[model samples]
Target: MICFNIIQLFVILKLCSGMRYIDLKSNFISDGVEVQHGYFMTSGKYKMFHARDPALEVIQFGETRVFPDVDYTPGTHSLFVEQFKVGDEEALSIYVFRMSVTSNSVVYKVYFHMSEFGYKLIDCAKFTELIKGKIHVSLDLSKSKSHPFFNIHTKEEHGQSTTLIEIRKSIAGFRLRNVEAKRYEFGRIMDSSFPIYMGYSKLNMFLTKATSIFIHKEDNRKYIVLRHWTKNIRFDLMTVNGILAWNAITDPEPSLLEDMHQKVFRLRDRIDGYRALNPLSTLDLAENISPELLGIEKVTGRHGGSTYALYHLEIGKEAYNKIKFVVNSEMLDMLIAKIDDRTLYAKVEVITNSQRTFLIITCLMKIDLVYETVINYYDKPNMENTSYYHVPEPYQTKIVSDMYKKYPVLINMDIDNPPSIVDHGELQYDSYILKYFRIKQEDGRGSVLSGKYAFGDIWQKDLHEIGNIPYEGNKRRLKVIAHSVNSSRIIVKPKNMEYPLLPEELQDYVIIDG
Candidate 1:
């Protein structure tokens, strides 16, 4: 009986596993004509073509309209037709064409032609190919009004020839061969209103639908506008929404000015903090100081024209601080040519102290003269000078260290391995305790110690074989010392190139030697 019960349990488990892997398909059909299996109607002036599916109830052909004939090739004439209901009644229809099937999926070429003008079915395959990949169509029905219309335009490359039309209407149901089908209900409405239809094909898998609303209000007037789009649809929805809401409020006075003032204050505070940290970094010097010295100057020429020169300078820390505080203040409004060289110049800014700003301005002044100590000789000479000033670094390092201390190091255990040394400190170590016998001490007193004290062979093998342990206790501790170190190891001693043994394979693996 026990054996039989076990067999029954095994069978039940197998069935459950099989059930989890099952794929079910639901079929839906609407009151429309299918266009896959060929069908024809002879009761009208134009024969209606449709598919053999029972879900598609009626098929009617729309009259073809063409523009004025022009002198063109015989086969180049654009020809297209729409299919609709016989009595001009509101009805939905889907046009499906079997192409090819592969693997477990069937491919069909679909086009959704609506009765509304300017509505044309977007070819899924062609659209996917244009996008360079397949994407599923996301359908959004929340903002749909009466039926959604998709406008599509197709044109051949390098040519002006094209065809445009409005086809199929009142698409209440649709289905793919050997796949699932969906049905939509369109309740009683005017002859102009019909159910919404969505076209899908194997090639176009990714699609999205979105909706938007716009509102405008002024004085006592209010306007609400709703807009929606699917991967197959397009239209602009709104310019603004809060405009109407603000107008509706009792107090409509603009408060944006006050908000702007508050934002400015906050921005100023942030800038002040940044400037405090980077005291020597200056934008004013880059804009005003350098440009003034490097401005164009006129030399000897038939036409007096300006010539500009580029100059650059790098200064040491001591000179950087002095220039920062003195040059800007003493020569704020001074002309470049009078102070130093006026031809070309540059300044190098560096951070020295949080409280002190620094700058090193170098200038190249040029003078153009046509003359000579001897007759029939001309010479032009240019002069350059470099200078800088800034606060000392002993003060800067102190402030930087204080700022670093403000943000303490936080150890993250979620990482595969913890940092070896956090904030310039080593992690605590635990000794491994062993349960075996112990050796006698020099003073003739013996105590419990690791098994390695007497059984070296067994202890060594156990240390290599045992996996990582949480902690070492007095009783079950191994004689070996296993340290829980962080991943980033800065080895200061024995730097000659020695690889440290990793803790264990299961715990962590080292990707780099550190």
Candidate 2:
């Protein structure tokens, strides 16, 4: 009991004496690398310490040190420190700590810091994770483009990157996951999902891509008002003009901040609501958390009379069909004009709000697009047994010999080397398409008459519909005329050099691009 009292007294005095400064963790005396506490800089002071050693207190995430000296106000401070150990070189380090307090302890969290000239490669990480193990060694490949053991070459072709890794498994020094979430920003993006999220409890604002910082006089605190469009009214990171970072408390707006919190939780409620929904049986499941999304295409359209994105998302196993994604924030809707949606893998659930239901992406963790099957499908498919198209009917053998000359680009494809259309005949499955067909003949030189799917996505049969679709701001699209599936659906150009049929009403309309 007496020992406990002394320790308590010392802690109380440390807090009350206004000595709210932490001595930098000693280099050797501090706790060495342990998964949970490895990254936490140990607390201590040494005789070898320089005057600027106190600045190292800021090099933490989670709950920052309760240091009274290190200013959390906006602006960058450059500190140069000599080697922590004797006879070692110096380093330039600046670390940003995220704030989160647990049981009076400053929880060491994520970190992004600059080093002198080389990476401080540690074999172990500061946090616990099963997927990634840390790398112990450092490489000087930047100085000289050579590795003693491994040969790495990168090739870029047609907007795609391919890397050949021939290294032996004996190389335990190389990490399976080069980056982990608890240590940095990048690994999560590559291994997890995009729009990496981090929250700060010290202030009532979200900071990302900050622009300008403002310091208030009466409060003498750093305050940032961010404007975000990605979600939760994503506020663009607030930064100061000419200066990089600013941290201040929006102390005056307690009620306003509470209201904002209410709004944020409301979004969270919507997310939970989405997860409760039973996903489509047709869609591939994502470990039952949600339906998997194979890819994303951003569409600009009007929603509720206002401009927003109607995301055209690719569902599992189907490439041509699409599912729509709704936004969690109006701010994200506002950014519809600016967003450039990349082809990414995502998982989403359906939510019902305002008597309407839609799918929304709620992240657990996202993976990269799996395209091996797609690549192989193109290279290995037997075209004869698939849904294929070609020049339909009498146009298959007509005066259209000159059609190729008239529109070389339009008539291009494997026109002469046609594949026999698929005949399922009696095969049964979950689903199958009923399409028209004809057997291909290996007779003469390939010509525009021989049919194949390669020529183009749009055919002249769709010309009438395409020619009359309404312009922007109009929701109307083409409505194809009904026809029996047994009969082929193609129109001979000009009916022997004349015009094709159109809906009686649109006879006056003419296609502009055509």
Candidate 3:
């Protein structure tokens, strides 16, 4: 490919009382190779111009003309101006003349040489003749213009020197000496039976673009119409108060929720809602307990065998102040107790203003619990973990370092690994490891410890083993052991651990069975 950094070109148009100008800069790179030789038209009117190096002095003018009736032979022509000094006068001449075509098949001859003028007219007819059987001619008038300074300024004579007008034109002058014939063939036409326009509003101006659609036929007499366009389609239906603006399509708004609701109702006519009846008698007891008493108004219950239940508590607004103080104290206690772990993952949240405080609890299996903690920002928050026991700045580093020491296996995964839920025995976690390495840092007390560890693993061995495990072993196969630490916190630990019997050291290992 040939890269060309084109300088700016300006065209000034003058009207009766106003003037307008157009500025343009073009960049192009040509492969110097052709696929299906043809003629192409420029988007706007333009003329080709040539200039000498250094001073960019213009010396000649010409235009390119194509004769499509000629054979479709594709190639490139590179020509540059050669200049010289003519005894007290600056004389310009052609420097290089080269034409490259397919297969190294080229012919040439010198037609005329003006030795006194320091120029020669090379015969391009022989070269054109060779490709006459397979040439496609295209016209290019981009080079037909007077030089930049031509006729614009008065010429001044400086003792015994004569000025010459520089000409700028297309090099199609070669066409006058050589001729080739070619033809054109049209391609397949595009289908037009589809939505033609899409509209969007920004501030006040309405922007639109051409769109396409597809139609599909269904069973007996039904049909489906699909609109294919950019996903970011938004329209402002109305704007009021300069604060609330409703933006949506006027037609029926598409919604996955509505479709899911309809599907659920169609499955069973007697079902009122999608919730299963709570079998544990504590369902009503959960609602009676005040959020202040429980620390949080939420608790998880289990059928004690397999199934689990989540309880949510609601209180009136009158109890807000009392519950707020009590909940805060409980939260502080939970936070302090969690400080011993290398990394603390918990949620201490309270929704205020309502008369009644509400608490929500969700029951999670071991794998679900661990996976959520490692990947979920809400659980393993990025908040600064500082305390009066240590300097605030290095608290996060200390916690992360301690976490690695306690769970060294988790740090071995490369940082570049693809995003996914990975299960190793009782522990399930999501890791994004692309690169692997380790770093060490010291605390304010001067205790050196390894900090950051990143790595990537492409093998998906655990996924395959889990998929093939028998039902009998899988039933008793616990992935994790989860425990509720308090009203707002839960902790999960992997129960299975095993060492591979391989001779070489195991690069990465996951607990598969307890």
Which one is best on lDDT?
A: 2
lDDT (10s digit) by residue, model 3, range 1-514: 8543322111111122121111111111111211111111211111222322211111221111111112322222222222222233221222223343332121321222224443334344532332223111211112232222122122334322222221222233322122421111111111112111111111111111112212222232212222213322232323221212223342222331233223323322322221332111112222221232222233222211211222222323222211211111112121211111222212222111222222221221135245322211012222333211212334545534533553211212211232111222221233211222222332112223232222212222132112222111111222222131111111122233233332233233321222
Clashing pairs counted in every model: 40, 21, 45
User: Runs in model 3 with CA error above 4 Å?
Assistant: 1-72, 75-406, 411-514
Residues 74-95, model 1: lDDT tens digits = 2211111122223332222234
Listed in order, each prediction's TM-score against the native is: 0.16, 0.16, 0.16
Q: Write the per-residue lDDT of candidate 2 for residues 23-61, one digit (tens) a residue.
A: 233121111111101111112110111112122222221
lDDT of 2: 0.25
TM-score of 1: 0.16
Q: C-alpha displacement of 455 in model 3, angstroms?
A: 3.1
* Candidate 1 segments whose C-alpha is farther than 4 A from its true place: 1-397, 403-514
N/CA/C clash count, model 3: 45
